[model samples]
Target chain A: MSNQEILNKLRDTIVTQDIKGCEAAAKEALEADISAFDAINGGLAVGMKIIGDKYELGELYLPHIMMSAKAMDGAMGILTPELEKDKTTESIGTAITFVQQGDIHEIGHRLVSIMLSVNGFNIVDLGVDVPDETIIDEIKKLNGSKVLLAGSALMTTSMQGQKDTMEAIEKEGLRDSVKIMFGGAPISQKWIEEIGADATAKNAADAARIVLKLMD
Target chain B: MTNRMTPPERMMAVMTGQKPDRVPVVPFVLGYASKVTGISLGDFYADGDKCFEAQFASMRLHGYEQTPMYGYASMGAFEFGGEIEYPYGKGQGAPFVKKHPVETIEDIEKLEVPDFKKELPGAYKQADRLASRCSELGLPVSVQVGSTFTAASVIANTSEFVSWLIMEPKAAHSLLDKVCNMFINAIDYFAEKYGAENMLPFDGGPSESNTMISADMFAEFAYPYMKRIHTHLKELGVNSVLMHPCSDQNKNIPHYIKLRNEIGWSGKYVWLFGPETPVKTQVEAFGDHDIVCGNINPSLFITEPYEELLEICGQNILEGMNSPSGFILAAGCEFPPNAAPIKLMAMLDAAEKYGRYE
Candidate 1:
């Protein structure tokens, strides 16, 4: 397949959640001498954007979105080493992801991580149920460089942890050095304002785009 | 001169939109039961008899009107071949993803209708056993059907599930349909053997959390299944349909009320439980169309002193029983296993002191 044809096929396979088709197309794209960046940008990322749009419009559901992400991850796994062979890189900023203390809902954080990683951002995953002090400690370790400090809480009761994390960062004089983003089932724009979050997104795709905007 | 009613009688009166001597206290006591009955979490989940004994013991000890019947976080997902990890502590348990079980489009196409007999006979047997026990004890039993999105999270991982909703819309719908159908079948089987009059309470924990998806996604995914499930339960003669979605479900209250109306459940027959939804909101939105069961934060169980607990319970009774009916005092979610026994006693005492009707 031509490079363009391969990328299009890969995108289609991801949209349909054809895991095998996505893997095959990814390999074919690699063989066609397409750069890793082009394969990701022209094929996977763009396809995911379209899928996300349809989902928001009620054209998609959870299982389908999950399948598409798996397919994209599969294709990305094949392209990462090859992409590293070439030294060209895009600097899309950095994001630190964690689930708030007393909350173990990592699904949102995982989705946000996948979306940001595939869309050309550096992701530092802090895993699930991380404490506020730990987040603050991590931020201080990163010095004064601006990074997206994103937290997710699946429980309404646990959302307080997000607020506490922000407070801890502010106490450490690191709040201004980081931009905070919050999302989860209980999180809302009102919650963002209440918690003093720098930004909030309805879903993972929006989160990535918002983080990019904040970084820029 | 008047006599005091039993916990169940007091609760039933409140449920039926009639004056009770005082407000009934029905705290969510799942883990508390586990602690009281000396039953391990694994056994409580695997055997319905043990669960029944444990729940009944806990309720009897605490003088609660209701007993929490679901065990572990992943019982609903286990019916769909999901694996759950039970952590040994008072902390919330974790669910680990061993595999997707369905990966390719062909896998989706070849999806088998989950056979309860073959797949997870334990779940059905347990439900039946619990129902029988509830009948014998003359105590109402509530069965939990997990939220659609929450169930999907266990089987395919939450991130993967949300991504699929975005990237593979068709496949997502297909999976959701299958999950919903399985849940309906499970509920039908249980209701048939246990009697449809039994309360069918759904535990849609993550969906209500609202941190994972938007209100729009909830309307599209969680609401439809809830309507179908509630409708099915009502058809089986289960008039009371209680939804326990553990987060702030304030945004979706209107949708829940609409579902109740569609199911033909009267105001007194519908119950919505969550931590963030205040009793005032329930009264405002449904207007006695349903009972607002809970908003007592589980944290209070651990944090509050005995006297303070009683005071808070009394205050909640005053605030929640605005209509003198259509209100139940319950923990927002399952009470933490480690809650002070004295706190529960204080709640029951408050009910006794203030719940009596002349």
Candidate 2:
């Protein structure tokens, strides 16, 4: 099959939430001797990007996104070993992401983490309710490598924690070492300025684009 | 004419589709009440007396048209044997489901309906006392109950609930049925004290927002349950319901208006933050029972310089007030606890300035 055909098949499997179809597509790409990089970039990444786009457009929901994410992750697993020989361990920029302390609702941040991973950024997901110290610890533990410290606040009540995290980074002497970004229902461009965040994202796709630009 | 009407009278006038002396400003004032009352939020919640005082103080401070039955945006899962982390003190964000009670289909199968009034003792006592207090003072009261979908999110935890919707949808429905029963039981308890038509808030889960879910998924998972509850309340004679589905509900706005009409919620019912639904669009689509609640950005309420913010907010007032649909000035979502008092005043101030009919 042509690469476009294989990519289209893979994307359909994800959008349709056909997990078995995703595995079969990965196997078909292998038989065609498609490079692992293209298989992932052109196949898995393309599928996830569509999922993200549809999600933003409100054409999709959590179940579809969740089911598709699982499918895409499975296909990536099948292709990663094949790419291991040619791909360097140092893939690209690193991002440290979490739900700021006291804000536990994190599906948005989780999607952003998944999208960032698919787009080849190293994601250090600290899960929900992460303290500034943990974020600082993750950055310093990276041994002077630049990283993106991303946080999200689902509640307006906890939005102050985003600013607190930023202040904590500055106090911990890692202010210049990392760029902070936030996203959620409560954040706006005005509030983003009030809080002093480096950037704000509407969704995972937007987050990926911004993270890529920040890295550049 | 504007200053002659008391807060409750002004609010009542609008609910019945009459011109109040002025536009009624009804921002959601829950945790923020504690801040103005000089009580810790935990005390306000944990102690019913303090909660009552805080609510009243919040009304006096904000010049809100209703007595505060204001409460945490929770589904009361903790009272129903779910693990919830109640925010214990000041600056603690709202409580949330700490651990989901249902992890498997078996867990869902074993669920039993808890006694609503007995389960949430503090909330009931507070609501009962607050209602009586408001009654004596001739004030209006507004309180919120989470919808079955939101309660299910709290009871099952959101991540697991989504999995159930996909994998074990039958169990998901069963759990939602159980939570709906809990809500009904609570409503039944409150309906006796508060009038049949006076329930203030019934939240449709934000997870069911069009931005968060597909129409198909919402139709299957959320719509039926919400319709069932709305129909249930209608049967009980409780008519006025505030359905706050936060964050950009433009995708589901038509369905919202349709659902309310279909279920015969003919009294004052609002779909707040069908966010960014144009005022003109809302009036045209909402038809006869059309009432525009709010679409103002809640984030704007926290920033500085009340005057400039009032100018921006004034546009929303002018448009909503000009619409044939009856209007109430409110934030798209809850008034942030940290939102400066002055900024909140600006919302009401704008309402009075630009919302005047005379």
Candidate 3:
């Protein structure tokens, strides 16, 4: 098969959410002498973009996105090591994602993290029920580098944790270097403005675009 | 002008599709009541008397039409012999499931519906006391039979439950059936105690929202169980039902309407929707047969200034007042516990100013 054809197979695996197929395609790309970077950017990332657009258009739902993300992760598992050997991996920017303290609903947070990762962002995933102090400590570790610190909450009670995390960032003098975004069922653009956060997105796909713009 | 109807009378008028003196304002106020009464939500959920007292006081303070009712989102876990944590800390909202009973497929086989009378949790005990108090005061006894799907989900981890709907349909069905049986048992208990004719059942649909699952998935997993529970409610001679479809459920409306029609459960469906579905859309869908209530964004209470809150509440009242069956202004979902009290008052004030009948 032609190298381009092999790359197309990689893309199809993600769009179709064929997890095993994605792993096989990654191997085929490796054998066909396709560069890992090209296999990712030219194939897997393109497929992710398709699924992301479909999700944004409401043609795809959570399970589809989740399966597609799993497919992408499988392909990345095969290609990441190869890319690392080349020492030429490039990322868009770093994003620190978490579900706010006292909330365990991480579906939205996981979706955003998956979208950002597939869009080439280095993700620091702080899992659910993360406190403000822990979030600030992660921000401190980012050390003045431009980062997108995103948090989500499923309940109104936990939603305040987002505000507290953002406030803690400001109190620790890390506000200027970081972009703060909040998303969840209860969050709104008006709430973001009220809480003095940087941005809010309608959904995970939109979150990727907003993070990209904020990074730029 | 002095009001011609008391809160109960106004609510009853709307429930029966008779013209009320004004539109009813029934905000889903739960923990917010505790916040108003200056009690720790931990204490509030633990003590039925306090929970009812706080809710009643908040109702009187706001002068809204609905009285205090006992129920929380994290319901099934505690009732099913799992653990739950109440909103005790600052900014803590409502009670949440601390542990799930049926964590695995094998656990589902071992699961038994607890005798609610024997294994009553804090909330259930409190609900019992609340109902007793209502009965003592000659008020209608209110009980919860909501989102059998949500209760089932709480019994397991939510994500696991959603995944089971797709991956393990049999297990999902088994769990849902068990939950329905549990609900039926609870309904029987409540009905036998309070007399079904004098009871009102509160239902909420948070897990079934389109944002969480596809409408097709909802139809498959949530619909049948909801039908079963409502059918039981109907069988028990319960006439009035208040259902809150808590979030964006435009896609799920047809299924809900179908359930209502199939079961022939009509009248005051406080079918309050979340802000994701507009009031106009809800009225257009449910206005003819059910008392359409709510669509006011709950976030507005915390984020928006008083003027904005008033304007939003007023807009919803305008859209909902002319509902053929009836209309009751309400927050889209549970009123935020941390929201400014004045914002809730804005809803009542809006109902009075803009919701009056000619």
Candidate 4:
């Protein structure tokens, strides 16, 4: 099959969450002279974008978005080493993911991580129940071109943690360097703007695009 | 003037937006019940009789106004043939899809509309037993119906379900429709058997979680199905249709209020907001449409001291009472099984102390 066809096949496999198919397609694309960068962008990245669009447009739901991320990761498992071997890659973007302290909802943040990783962004997953200091410390460590500070909380009391984390970033003089995106059971655009966040997506796909735009 | 009522009677009154003796306290007490009955969480799920006994025992012990039957995680997938594994002592866990039964459009074509009588008699029988027990105890029984998207998520596997929404909208809708129909049937059977006056169809859709999809998506996918269920329950003589959507669902409360208004169920339906939801904002948004229930952090029951629990319960009841429309004190979600029983009792005590109606 042609390289473009291989890229197209990889996209389909990832979109469909065909884990085995994605891995095989990734290998075939690599063998058929497809550049790792193109394979990552045209194949995995494009498929994720389609998933995101569908998610935003109300076509895709959470479980499917999650599987698509898994599928992308499956393909990435095969392509990551190739890109590292070539050592000729460009940065897509960078994101910081975490479930703020007192909020133990990570399924959403995990999806954001997968979407960002597949889209070629560096992700520093701070893990669940993360404190403000920990998030700031991670941001200092990664120091990516743009920071995607995210939080998820399933309860109202923990909503303050999101506000507190963003406040800490601003207090630490790191607010300008970072772009905040918040989503969870309770977060809203009003709350995001109220807490001084840069942006808030309704779901993970919008989150991915919002982070990319913030980076741009 | 109406005579003052006890906390239980007051709670029932408040649920209908009447002047209760004061604000009623109905702590979400699934785990609290298990602990009260000394039944292991494993026994609660594995044996329906034990689960009902524990549930009734917990409610009676705490003087709880409502009993939340069924785990939030179980409802979403169980009806769709998903396999569930309960870890007993551990909290409720999500049901995993052992088989995708619907792999393609042809598979969808072959899919049969689930016959609740044939398929869910065991569950309904359990519900019947619980309802009977609750009736004997002169308490109310509330059964949970899995939320459409969350249910779909479990059946399709979270990622696959979301992906299918985007990749296969028609198929997703078809699948959701089937699940909705099955739940409606199950709810109707339980309502009829249990008496509609005793039924509360708790739609466990986590649309408010903000993790699943956008408000627009919820308006399309989650809200309509909920409306249908609510409408059907109302028609079946169920006076109250309480929705238990977990998450910071502040944005969606208005939508729920609108649904209640459109369905002419304004005073009858109760919007059970999760503790993660911004209560003040939601109360303000809901503003007299339907009764507002909950926002007590469930974790507090397990973590907080009895005094602290009373203070929070007292404060929430006071706040709700201050409103033109009254409130029902409830946990954000199901009360964790390990929650200190004393704390739940303290909540009841606080309601009795401060929830006195003039």
Instruction: For each candidate, report its DockQ versus the true two-chain complex.
Output: 0.14, 0.52, 0.50, 0.15
lDDT tens digits by residue: candidate 3, B1-358: 4758889889878877789998888888988898778998788887888988898898888888878788887788887778888777645677777789989988889888767677564467788888888888777788778688889988997766766775689999998888888888888888999899888888886888777778898888888888888888888888888888878888999898788789877545668888888888888888888888867877778778888788888888888799888888888888888888888888888887888896
Whole-model lDDT, candidate 1? Answer: 0.69
Q: Is candidate 3 or 4 superior in lDDT?
A: 3
- Model 2 clash tally, residue pairs: 0
Residues A25-81 of candidate 4: C-alpha lDDT, one tens digit per residue: 999988888878899889888888888788677566565677777777777777888
lDDT of 4 at B111: 59
Give candidate 3 misplaced runs (Cα > 4 Å).
Answer: A27-40, A73-86, B1-3
lDDT of each: 0.69, 0.74, 0.83, 0.68
- What DockQ was computed for model 1? 0.14
lDDT of 2 at B238: 69
**Which candidate achieves the best lDDT against the true structure?**
3
Better of 1 and 3 by lDDT: 3
True-vs-predicted CA distance for residue A184, candidate 4, Å: 9.9
Clashing pairs in 2: none
Tens-digit lDDT string for candidate 2 (A1-216): 687899888878987878889989998998888877877777788788888888777677787788887787788788878977776546567888898787787788888998888788778999988777788789889747768877888877677777777777778888787877889777888777886778888888899888888877
Superposed model 1: Cα runs more than 4 Å off: A1-104, A111-216, B71-73, B89-100, B103-105, B116-122, B199-203, B266-270, B307-311, B349-358
Candidate 1 lDDT tens digits, B1-358: 4667877777777777777766677776765676687876556655678778998888788777775565444544556555444434223333333455555545656655576555444265666677678777666666766565566555555555566665666777787777778777777766666677665555566543444455776787677777777666767777665566656666666676677667776534445466567777776776546666646776566556888878877777776676434677777776656566887887788776655456
DockQ of 4: 0.15
